[model samples]
Target: MNTRFKQLLQLSAAALLVTSSSQALAWGQIGHRVTGEIAELYLDADTREKIAALFPNQSLAELSTQADSELSNPSEFWQQTWTWHFVTVPEGNEYSLDKHAPKEGDAYTALTSSTETLKDPKATVEEKRIALLFIVHLIGDLHQPLHSGNGTDRGGNDVKVEFFWQPSNLHRVWDSGIIDNQNLSYTELTKWLSQKITPQMASEWRTTDPKTWIKESIIIRDGIYPEEPKLTYDYQYQHIATIKQRLQQAGVRMAAYLNEVL
Candidate 1:
């Protein structure tokens, strides 16, 4: 098989394995890969070469999901990273660095630190590797509206509901429930989205500021919560466009961020 064909098979297999094996988290494997796939399209040649030097074997699509999967680690380091996948702004307010800054650190803090680590000449290869991984995952997470949660409801994890008659929460619905319901592999979704993302859209979404990205998610977050306990096509219909846009934005912004830092 050709390389692109093999890559698609691998991505499909990975998506199936991760979806079946773990509880979905932070856009799950598919959304993470979708963002990564999109980012690869926009990465300049120099940035691509730099990343390839750092990671000869793994692609950005694979690394983008690593942080979320690492949550299964029993180490203190992993435990501390739980907050890094998300940030909570109150439902009514915009993100304020002062007020939203958690002592334990959140996505915003982690994104900044990771970027600095990657840019530091003194940093080790391992440090840069880990930083790049966080940068990829956190970019995807910040675009996920639920991850930019309100201080209440644990980013909608507490909001119980039935998604397509299955027991689910609002958070999972946004993460993977709706996407999963569509029955497309990450590669398929990525291909479709790649075709749809115009150069203008990519440019518009290419803001390098993580704070601006988080603020966008907050505005989307405040508007997405549903009053009804049962969700189906209507909910998915209303929000899938937002979901697609956020994924595309994350990818575009991630490329810009990486090109600037690396």
Candidate 2:
């Protein structure tokens, strides 16, 4: 292979490694990988067609690649705006007391934004692709329990600790430890997960709201935080099934979100 092709393959390999490790633990979690997969799958035909219109000569794969790159390291402007969409209206005083729930009318009230933002009509094809991709990941992130935790912790960043004998911070461990322990490729992991997903689950998890997702994560997060210095395979397997389910759901839902607005 040419040097450029070799480099591309290496980059893809690295990304795959990053994504697989993210499953067990990472700043992002399976949400990122699942959403990434979904964004690649769920874009509406019209949006896909529109993006093609903008780039008459480019293949869909190429466009998607460009989009992923643009979103790899989002700008501050993109982060804040995309972050807001994940906020949900808190249920009531009951939920209000729970810091995770938003107040009746918070600055980030989700209703204010449409899924259309996921694919801005006026932006360039690459720009829209980037936006859509980010939304996919952000939606998944919103569903992560730590992402919705108390602001002071920076989503577990404040918690100092070790994991699996590794000298690491709380957030860092969860971001990339346990899953890194798996030592698998993205294709291998996805295949293993896809085989386990039932049709009923795929249908049920397809939704746009992030609050409900976050609530689910909060429950999982609660169960995960035990006063222990080391985590074992048992701890990892405790929710392996659920973790796979979440990733599958994220992919399907991400596609739905883009299909609706794009």
Candidate 3:
């Protein structure tokens, strides 16, 4: 086969892989957009202007899904970035670069790397734009407790369950089920949750430290497993608040990072 034909075959395989694996992406598209919209609200005026210049017609909400969509791209960057959506901080141990972070990268390292990219004067526009997409995606991903998971169970992907009478995994339930279960559009969800975020809440959540964010997610992950694997209204009732809080916090923190970096 010619080089061009070989490239086409590889691209087709990657696209198939993306289709099979998109369900496992952090926060699905809606949850990530919700965080992006909320982050849009909290951006500094100057930062907003700068971001507009970089993104052209794109809003953060649209950009939020870019990384997940890129899973289909026939590129090494996308291959490496698939791992950057989540991390394993094994139960009972705090995260450390030497102990927990792998050379392959994780949401924590991705955030730090993106921040540095945006902050670097020498970085090209395309480089910073790719980094910005990651910030938009990874910030929300880390907030999904399972993304900062125990090394086992594939971040609860292995812990299968029935969500509202349908087959699902624990990770999917947290990633999109709880929020998607509401049937609200991303804008409505963002508006509803954004109102509850007080000045103090956003201020308190403004830390740029990814370790602190991962720590918070790890604590929440431990308590989230349901005794009954078949989840319904009661399960939603018990955990919906945590989902809302994390979504809101992710948005707040995402904005804070952009405000500080850009």
lDDT of each: 0.81, 0.48, 0.83
lDDT of 2 by residue, 28-69 (tens): 433355445544555677866754564565433232223123
Better of 1 and 3 by lDDT: 3
Task: Please give, for residues 1-262, the per-residue lDDT of candidate 3 as tens digits.
Answer: 1232223224343332243234338888789999999999999999999899888878999888878887766565465567888889989988897888777677777777777767878666666677777788998888889999899899999999999999999999998898899999999999999999999998898987888888999999999988989999999999999999999999999999888888
Stronger candidate by lDDT (2 vs 3): 3
Maximum-lDDT candidate: 3
- Model 1 scores what on Cα lDDT? 0.81
Question: Candidate 1's residue-wise lDDT over 1-262, tens digit each?
Answer: 2232223223332232232124347998899999999899989999999999988977889888877776665544554677878988887787787999787778888888777767878666666776788899899999999998887899999999999999999999999998888799999999988899898888788789888888888888888889899999899999998898888888888899999987
Residue 81 lDDT in candidate 1: 70
Model 2: lDDT of residue 219: 68
Clashes of 3: 0
Q: How close is candidate 3 to the true structure, as a TM-score?
A: 0.90
Q: Lowest summed-lDDT stretch of 10 residues in model 3?
A: 1-10
